[model samples]
Target: MNEIIQLNILQFSLIYLLLILVLILMKKSKISQSKLLLLGTFRMSLQLVLAGFILTAIFENPHPLFTIAYVAAMVIFSITRILRKNPWLNSSFRWSVSLSLTLTGLFILGYFTQIVIGVSLFNPQYTIPLAGMIIGNAMTGITLALKTFHESLTSGRNRMETLLNLGASPKQILLPDVNRALETALLPTMNSMLGMGIIALPGMMTGQILSGTSPSTAILYQIAIMVAITAAVCLAVFCSLHFGYRSLYNQRNQLNLPR
Candidate 1:
């Protein structure tokens, strides 16, 4: 077993103080001139502590059912966050995001685990963290795509209406906006993957190397993760846009703008 290096109270306090100093600098730069710094830090610390304890308990027991349950909880929590972030979205949009994220994330994760790696029993150590990363990224992509689509539809309602009146179908009128939104959602992932090793070391790859994995092995994992993220993001964004279009049009296929 790797020796667990513990941070003394004084060290932990100094680390937190450094974080606060960084936040203060950020505020001074007008990056975020709100009390959100303190609140966000507090929430982050609390959540991390709670998650640490819960993960510790799960790691000790390490049952398959428990692992599966935790993964499901992560997906559900992520979906709920997506819905909360896009409160204006209808139920169908929410369900589509949930379904897309779960299906895409699970498919990528399952392929990586069962076919690529082929680990026996699907250990929680690998599955949970990997699934969390993929699902989290997918959630972000879906949310961004949906938000962009909704904003574009609402803002371009007049243009869309004109197009519809000119005999354009809903899909035709919306495809340009939907495609743009999906591209916007995908740009960050694409850029990160493209510039990964050249620009900066990714967190996962760095952590893997720090934890004593070989560079080759870490690179392989990083590649797999990047591919999975791309696939999941594309799937989630496409699904969100496809389902979100329904909410923007009425029974007669006319664009509905909220007055």
Candidate 2:
């Protein structure tokens, strides 16, 4: 194995110049995101610094219960973020989206960690990072799907009602919106796949190579991760939309979405 290059605090401190440059450019461009950009960078740095220590502890003492607890916390945080993104949501929609993301994300992460990587169930080295990647993608997938679905239905309510009055079933009325939402949710993933090598080397592969893993080994890991991410996104969107559309109605079968 090769030794990885280490970065000094000086080198790390230099990276902040990028943030300064971004803030300055945003101010000059009148983008109005200077505060947001600064806060985002600060928040990310704080979280990652804390996470570095927490993850080190977890790695040092890898227990199944601890791993499960950490993963649960991650999913809960993700669900909370998703809910924040889709406010004015009904109770049913609230629960369904959380369930869909949780179930799909955990299942895919489990399979990738245990079967694909052939690692122990609670191996922090495999579980934490892999779960992070899977959960992040699933989060984005559900967010896009929910946003598109809600916007489509609300914007096209008259058309949907027309179809319903025309004697179409709820599923039939919402099918186009569902399809459009699913497509919008998955489009980025599809494009990433199309441009994987030619456009950019993905994060996981690049990180692995930087950490001394062979290029071939890193590439294989990246491929497996991409496949898992795509599958997880598809499953999360499908599950969310499948149950979500139904939740838009009351027991009387009338449209009862949250205003």
- RMSD per model, one decimal: 2.4, 1.3
lDDT tens digits by residue: candidate 2, 1-259: 7899799999988999888788788889889988788788889999999989989999898888888888888999999999999996788778888999999998998899888788886888899888899999999998998888888877888887887778777777777888899999999998899999788999999999898999999989888999999999999988888888788776665776555
Clashes of each: 0, 0
What is the C-alpha lDDT profile of model 1 across 1-259, one tens digit per residue?
3544567888787877677677778888888744776788889999989988888998898888888898999999998998888887766666777787887788888887888789643578888888888899998898888777778878998898898889998878988998999998999899888899999999999888877788899999999889988998898788777776677677788766443
TM-score of 2: 0.96
Relative to the true structure, candidate 1 has a C-alpha RMSD (angstroms) of 2.4
lDDT of 1 at 78: 93
TM-score of each: 0.90, 0.96
Q: Which residue pairs overlap in candidate 1's backbone?
A: none
Question: For candidate 1, what is the TM-score?
Answer: 0.90
- Candidate lDDT scores, in order, read 0.83, 0.87
Worst lDDT 10-window in candidate 1: 1-10
Model 2 bad stretches (over 4 Å): none
